[model samples]
Each structure stands twice: as C-alpha cells, then as structure tokens.
Target: MLEKIFKLSENKTDVKTEVLAGITTFMTMAYILAVNPSILSAAGMDSGAVFTATALAAFVGTLLMAVLANYPFALAPGMGLNAYFAYTVVIGMGYSWEYALTAVFAEGIIFILLSVTNVREAIFNAIPKNLKSAVSVGIGLFIAFVGLQNAHIVMGGATLVELFSVDGYNKLNGVNATMNDVGITVLLAIIGILITGWLVVKNVKGNILWGILITWAIGIVCQFVGIYVPNAEVGCFSLLPDFSHGLSIPSIAPIFCKLQFKGIFTLDFVVILCAFLFVDLFDTIGTLVGVSSKAGMLDKEGKLPKIKGALLADALATTAGAVLGTSTTTTFVESASGVSEGGRTGLTAVTTAILFGLALFLSPIFLAIPSFATAPALIIVGLYMMTNITNIDFDDLSEAIPCYVCIIAMPFFYSISEGISMGIITYVVLNLLTGKAKEKKLSLLMYILAILFVLKYAFL
Candidate 1:
C-alpha cells in the first residue's frame, strides 16, 4: 500500500529509509516550534497559543506537502517572516496584530489564485536567475542576523548595530557596555555556535538538534549554579519556566480567525500585502529549487514536475497559518537534511507531519526550551543557506550589482520584501542602462512589478 501510494521503490527507497529521513527532517526543523512563539509573542500574541498554532500549522502544512506535492518538504512559520510580522508590521507600521494577520491571509489568497492560474510560475520564470540566487543568500544573512540578536551576540545601537566581543567589552568605546551584565549569556551563545559548528563539520546526522539540546542543558546547569537569574539581562539563558502541568493545550481561540480587516484595505496595507506575497513567492521558489535539485525532483528544463501542487500546498498553508494566528508558513529549506538522509517521496513528508501533530501535545516540554538555545539552530541554518552565494555569477556586473544590493539590503534594512524590491528595481534599471533590456527583454509582468515596487518604496 505504501509503495503504491509513494512509489518508494521507484525513488530507490524503502519504508525504513523514508521514515528515518522524515525523522531527520523533522529534527532539523523542530526548532521552529520553539523559535516561532518566541518571535510572534512580541506582537502581543499569547506565547502558549502561538506555540500550538505553530505546531498545528506545521502539521497541516507538511501533511499537505506530502499528499499534494508528494515531496519531502516541511512547512512552518518562517523565521524572518515572523520577525517582519512582529517587528515591522505590528510595531513599525503601527498596525494591529490582527490586521497584520489579515494581510497574511490576503497574501495567501493571492498566492492561491496565482498558483491555480499558473500565473505564479510565469512570475517565477520572469525573475532573473541571478536575482533568485541573491534572494536566497540575502534571506540566509537575514536569518543569521536575527538569531544573533535573539542570543544577545549582537546588539542594536543608536548609530548602528554592534557585535559584542566575547569579553563583554566594546572595542570602540573601551567601555563595559550592555553585554557586560550578560557576559555569561554571550559566552553560552558562543559555546553553542562552536558545538553546532563542530557537529556540522563532523557530519553528525542530527547535529542541529543535538546542538540545541546540549546548549539548553548547559543553560540549565548555569541557572543551577546561580550564574544565571530569571528575567535578568545577563540571565536570559537561565530563566526558568513553569512545568506544574504535565499535559495541557494552549487555546488558539485567542487568535484563531481573529483577523481585523477594517483598516487593512488601504494602499499602504495593499503594499504590505504585496510584500508578504512576493517574499513567500520567491522564498518558496528558491527553497523548491534547492530541495528539488537535491532530491532529483527537477526536470530537463529545470522545472518541478508537481510544482503546481507544491505551490498550492504552500499557499494553503500560509492561509491556514494566518487564520490560526501565526506568521507565513512556507516550505523549509532544512528539508534538504531529510533528502540527504535518503528521503525521496511523500512518505517522508507524512512522517514529518505526524511528528508535528505529536508536538501539539508536547507543547509544554517544547516551550521550556528557551530562545537562547533555539537561537543556535537558527544561526546554524543561516550559515547553511549562505552557501547559495557560491552559485551567483559575480563576473556579470549587471547581475552582481542587484544581487549584492539584495544580499546587503536584507540585513541592513531588516526586511526581506524591501531587499527583494531593491534587487528587482536595480536589476531592471541596470539592465536597461546596459542596453540589455530590449535584447534580453524583461517580461511584462516583471516590468509592472518593478514599477509597483518603486511606488511601494517611494510613496509608502
């Protein structure tokens, strides 16, 4: 039955291999369960509720990916997108979390429409390959930056952001600054990075998960030794969580279907929706390109065979996540770990989905894992994604300029959509100036998007 459904033998795999591969994929990305709540809570959502939503969203999304796309990709509330939801939209743009969620829901609907009509593929094919690679690398840097901030390894400043030295001293001012009190936390983060890096270097199968767990245990020990204190700047790694209840469910009703659309119909909100739409669109494409290439899911023309199904699944997941009270849920690049583990079919995705469903019941234990511990996993994954930079062609100045703009703008501007906008606009402008605009011919849709991106930045 399993063979008939997933065609495991044709993909050169058995049930055991697929199961293990699914476990490996789930283990690699499970940090999302911890990390998502930590991020979304800042948007004034209940941490516990967000945890449930995150898990449930992952379960549903991964299941859809398995059955619909028949691919091993997993979906979760994306790391950078969550930050955008919490920091930029809710805080920076002064929109309520509810309205922000409305924007996400809108974007998901747009994604579905585009995917169904096959317009999404046209838009994707319209993007210059160089810019696509750049978007991937840019997102990698952005995620790593977010992880470092979460772990207190990096601190924001009035003039600019500053990196904290391990000694807890500021080199520029020769002063013991903010990190002075949290020196131990900084040290733990460094130790976590080292452990994760070593494990990765050693080719450990579940190195990321192992790194997070080991670092978390060390933090518990630090708390026991009194080196860390709860809710203190220096003791972030040591804060103790309540575990009185062995098993409990956090109510998602607080945020479920709570989207407020009254103020979200404005032009600025439309631009915001477009931002979410483009980020999810390109990110999914880039992830699909990477994971599919590894799984041999791409065809002669470099197209995914079941791309419509895969994209529709992602679209639905984003919609479901918004309704359930979380950020954009999309395909995770970490699924590559499962592919490396010999996952070649939907069975692996199904296995991951089942684990995510189980995670719903274990929210208490999972929530106990602190932001600092999960921070390492994000940082490690960021480093892994950075490898995409090697594929960009630097020799072509026209391509490199936009790619470089994209790579730098994401972390600097703190927005993936902004980075993409800058990259696309630059790509269009540079190509026209270089006299390749007519020769190569930018797609009509790409031109319209480029214009919209300019207006979005200029007016809004």
Candidate 2:
C-alpha cells in the first residue's frame, strides 16, 4: 500500500510507516500556524484577525500544496517575515494593519508573477549548491542557538566580558535577593530539553507526547509547590472566534479607503520593501531547492520538479495567508523529516492537511499546549536544519564566503531574510570582482535582487 501510494527511492514500507510519517510531519509543521500568529500578534494590530486569517488560510493553502504540489514540503507563514510584519510595519513604521496587509499582498503578487513566469527558479540557479547546503546547516546552528538562549543555558552576565549565568545568586546592587525565578526557569527548560532529547534519541515516533507528559508532570509538581504557569488567555480551553467580528479582507473592504502614499516613495520604504522582497524570494527559493534535493524531488535537470507549478502553490499559500492575516509565504525545513517516514506522495500532505483541519475543531485542546513546551520542539528541529550547512564546499571562495555569510548573519541578525539579503549581495559582488560573473548564469531577477541588496545595505 505504501509503495502504491508513495514512489520513494527506497523500497516499499507498510501503511503504518506512511501514517506515522505523515503524523510526524504534521506535528512538526503544525507549529507554524500557532507560532507565526503568536509572534505577529505582538504587533498589536490586526493580531486577532491576523491570527484567525493565518490559521484558516494557512490551513486551506497548505492543503492545496499537499494535494496539488504532491511533495512533503509544507507551506505557511515563514519565520523572518512575520517578525518584520509585526516590527517594521505595525510597530516601527506605524502603518495600519490594512496597509501592512497591502504590502504583503503586493509581495504576494510579485511572488505569483515570479512563479508563473518560472523566472524565480532561473534566478536561484546562480546559488552555489554548497551555499544551499550551508543554509541547512546554518539553520541548524540557528535553532540550537535559539534553544540555548530560550533555555537560559546561554545568558549574559556582569563581567566586563559577559558570561552564561547559571545558579548564581541574584545580586541586587550589593544586595542578595531571596527570590530565584531564573533558576526555576532554567530548571524547567532543562527538564523539557532532557525529556525531548530522550524521546528523539530513543526514536519515539511521537516525541511531542513526551512534551505533554513532562509538562503535565512539571505542572503537577509546581502546583504542589505553589508555583504555576497560567494559561491566562484561555483556562485550558481554546476560544473560537466570533466570525461576525472576525476580519476578512478577501471578503470585506477592510477600510482600505485611502492609500497612505506619503512614505511609499521614500528611500526608507523602498529599501525596506526591496530588502523584504529579496529576502522573501531567496529564502523561499533556497528552502524549496533544499527540501527538493533532500526529498528526492529533483527532476532530470537537477531542478525542482514542476518548479514553476510548485512556486505557484507557494504563492497562492502566501496570498491566502495575507488575506487571512499573516506574514509572507515560506517553505518549512521540517518537511525533510517526513521523507524518513516513507511519505513520498501527496497523500502524506493530505494526511497532514486533514489533521490541520481537524485541529480547527479541536482548537481548545491545542490552545492548552503552551508556547514554552513547543519551543523545545522548534529548538530540536532547528538542530536538524543545521545539517544542511555541512554540504558547503569550504575551499571555494564563491561558495564558502556566501555560505558563511548566510550562516553567521542569520543568527546574528536574528532574521533569515537579512541573512539571505546579505548573502545574495556577497554572491553578486564577489563573482563580479573575480570576473567569474560571466561564467555563471545570472538571471534578470538575480541582478535585480543583487542591486536591491546593494542599495538596501547602503541606505538601510
């Protein structure tokens, strides 16, 4: 049955394997719906709507990808872009939630154009394979870095040189405070990490089960000790949105009455928009290429299978997310894990999508799952993503420099787009300086992205 459904490179597997694989992929990718919205909600504009829209649209859009694109790759609102959507638009620039939505829509349009034209893939051809691999490894390092920071295992201290503070007394201006909240946080984080690692290393099919079990155990213990992590938003139950009050741009006008065109022409906006565009383009391109390579989805030409059509799926996913209220579209790195389960066909995606749809009905159960608990899973998955970095040819300047740039810059800048933007700029200029530019196939899109990066760095 697995062979009938899945055309895997490896030999056939049982239905049980496919089911388990699908479930694992779903679990890993499910966080995007919850997390992307959570972070974007911080912007305090259209958050409720954005959250709802992102969830609903991502559900529908991802299903489309799963069924139509027929790959293990999962699509949803991405990492770096959501932060920008929240920070740059609604917070820093003080744009209305509507305009931010418009900006996203604009980018979505660009993405659709690029995909339909097959121009996006052409541009990505210039990226060295090693750099592509480096992106994966760099993402892994990123995840580990995030995990350490979140676990408070890595912290800053008061030495002239900062240090990771562990179990140190709370020194308050020459005074010792009796309370020690940091220690407790550290302990909880460790407990979560240890339990998660144990399950993963043990090859437990459902590692998240361990998270729930440990979380409950910790909760019970803390309750006995008169300590608790409250579910303030919902008392262990998720709330459904009153659709009458819910915002929907695709359905409603959304008060997009007048264009706030004043700041639109400014260099700041131009740089930011272009910066965002390039970041969106490359990150999505890189992820698709990486997952395609790992999933054995590469075509005879060494290009992603049905490259243009796949981009369309991604584009529609992004647009759907925007109307539903999220950031840009992106491919999930966790999709690679699904391949391990023999999930070679679109059925894997269908399984995942059905689960996501079911989740909407069981939102209450999901809401009960806390963010800190999920962080451990993300931290681990991030570790897995780092594996791609090792493929970079460290000896080649063209590949090595760009690879390193992307690896370090992403975590340092705390944004994937920023890292990608830095990388493309490096690739273009380095190739040009060495007179090796003529040797590589540089698309019009690449040139434009290269130029965008140059001016963005210069002004932004």
Candidate 3:
C-alpha cells in the first residue's frame, strides 16, 4: 500500500526510501523540536506549556505540508521570528508575551486571508523566481547565524593582534580577556568547514548530519578525556514531554486594547507585517518549488495544486500555536531532508506527525539534546542556503541590488522585515533610475509596501 501510494518504482521511492527520508528529515530538524521551548523558557514561561505547544505545532504543520501540499517540507515554530517574538516584541518592545502571541495569531490570519483570496498566489507569481530561491536561502543563512552565535562559533576578527576575538574582545584589555575562548570557537568552526569540504568532495550521503554527529561525538570524547570544558547537558536520552510545571497562556491582549490604536494604524506595523508575510510567503514557496522539483509533483500547468490549502494550513498552524501555547507556525525547511531520504509523498509526513504526537510523551529526550550538537547541523544547512546567492545575476545591477540588499541587510538590520523593506525600496528606486520600471513586476500592493517602508523607517 505504501509502495503504491509513494510510487517507488515511478519515483524510485520505497519503504527503505521513506525511512531514510524520515531519518534525514528527523536529524536535520530535530533541533526545532527543542528550540521552541528553549526560547520560550527565557521569557520565564512554563516549559511544560511550551513543550506541549511545540509538539502540537510541529505535528499539525508537518502533516499539512505532507498531506496538503504533498511536499516533504517539515514545519515547526520558526527560529529567528520566535527570538524576535521573545526579544524584540515582548521584551524590547515592552509588550507582554500574550500580545506577542496575538501578533502571531494576526500574522497567521493574514496569511490565510491572502491565501484564500488567492492574493497570495498572485504575489507568488509576481515575484522573481530567483527572489523565491534567495529568500529561502537567506533565511537559511539567518538561522545558521543564530546557531553559530549561540554556539559561540562565529567571532569578530581583525588582521593584527587578536586576529579573531570573542564578543568583540581584545587581549590587551585585561586578564579575563585571554585568547582561549576565541581559540575554541575558531577550532570548532574550522572543523565544521573541513567536514563540509570532506562531504562535498566525497559526495557523501547525509554529509551534514554525519558531520554534525561526528563533531558532537568528538566534543563528548574530549570532555571524557579531560581536554574540553562541556557547556552541554551530556546524558542519556529520555522520551517524554517534561510537563512538571503547570502550563498557562499569558493574557496580555487587554493591554493592547487599552493602548491607543493610533500607532497600529500607522504604516509601521503594516510594513512590518508585510515584510514578515513576504518572507514567510516566499520561504514557503521556495520549499514547495524545490520539493516539487524533486518529487515530480509539479502540475502540467506549471503550478502547485492545493498550494492555497497549504498556505491556509500554515496560517492555521500559527493560530493553533498561539492558542495551544507557542510562537508563530512557519513551515520547516528541514523537510527537504525527508525528500532526500525517499519520502516522495504525504505518508512520510504522516510518520513525522506520528513521531511528533508521540513526542509529547518524550519531551525530555528532545530538550536534552544540546544546542552545540544541533548547531553543526544548522551551520551545514546554512551552507546549502548560501549557494542560492550565486543565482543572483550580478551583471544586471537592477535585480542585483535588491538581491544583495536583502541578503546583506537581513543579518545587519536584524529584522527580516527591515531587510526586505530595504530590498523593496532599493528595487523600486533602481528600476526608476535605470529606466527599468516598465519591465518591473509592479503591483498596487507592492507599491503600498514600498511606501510604507519609507514612512516607517524615516518618520514613524
């Protein structure tokens, strides 16, 4: 039955293929199953509640990707966006977690609205194909950046004296400014790069996963041999959600109700939402495109069927998370790993959904897996994502500007929205100046989006 459904002979997919795909998908994205709770834990929220929310979100989202879009894309609470949820909106912006949840809920609703209206499809068609690929790759780089920073792997560097420094530290400063920390981080990054090279050269299957596991194992053995200081919780795995602390959703929407809606009506929030929506939208599109390319699922009409259903699924997943107790529900890029493993169809997603469902019984095992071990996997994925940058046509400066702007500005601006804003504005300005405006894929909605960025950035 499984063989018949996946059409292994046609797609060369089989039980062994599904299991391999499932395992690949699992290894790449296993970090996500844990990352959601870790970020939420920082907000002093109940870990138990966070774990429950994360599992439910992953199960629902992944199933939708598999069953709805018929793609191998995985889903989970988004990484960078959730950090922004915790750090920027909640803490930095002085909104409570509840308000943040409300914003997430709103984003999901907007996603659904656009999808159902088929406005979402129109936008996807309007975007340059390279932009779609770049957005996905850009996000991959963004997530990888987060992983490295968390692992203390990427450090600031200079030509002389310190060469590479940790946290912008310099040795001439003081006693605590010793070079040991920087040394370790550089060493790890180097090993990671070397492993990546080895994988590329050998064309090894599961290179990223294998490299990550190898690095983690090395780190573990180093600790055992008394050569390394361990920052990880090294231990045996336990499979079950840690529901020790009672779970409760934060209720902060009343605060927004009490506050003036004056700012909300302004272009700032709207622009931000548009930016978020665009990234989320394109990210989903690229995943679908890439997976479709692999699975031979593209329609003869040169479109993906049930794409609207997939969008609605994502939007609903976000809403489900906000209510059930987590952050935004974005589709997982790691699901491509499943496709690579032989999961050509939704049955693979079904298996993943089942795993996530059972995960509620085993949250401890998931959480116990340290970020450092997972960091390696993310770094490798980032490398894959970085390859998309090459697709940008540099000979034509018009399209080149937005591509470079979005890529460079995302990490610099520290908000994907701001980066996208810069990209849009740059694109518009470049088109007008270069006399390529006629050739532009201009839409009324896009013009509104560009105008909003200027207002929000300059005046608001």
Q: Report the number of the highest-lDDT candidate.
A: 1
Candidate lDDT scores, in order, read: 0.83, 0.60, 0.64
Write down the lDDT that model 2 would get: 0.60
Leading candidate by TM-score: 1
Name the lDDT value of residue 251 in candidate 2: 23
Model 3 misplaced stretches (Cα beyond 4 Å)? 1-20, 35-51, 66-73, 79-97, 155-213, 229-267
**TM-scores for all candidates?**
0.91, 0.74, 0.78
The candidate with the higher lDDT, 1 or 3, is 1
lDDT of 3 at 250: 26
Candidate 1 lDDT for residue 2? 97
Which tens-of-lDDT digit does each residue in 256-365 have in candidate 3?
A: 22222234554545654565567667766676676766666778986776777777778777767777667777777667667766687666776777777776776554
Candidate 1 accuracy as lDDT: 0.83
Residue 331 shift from truth in candidate 3, angstroms? 3.1
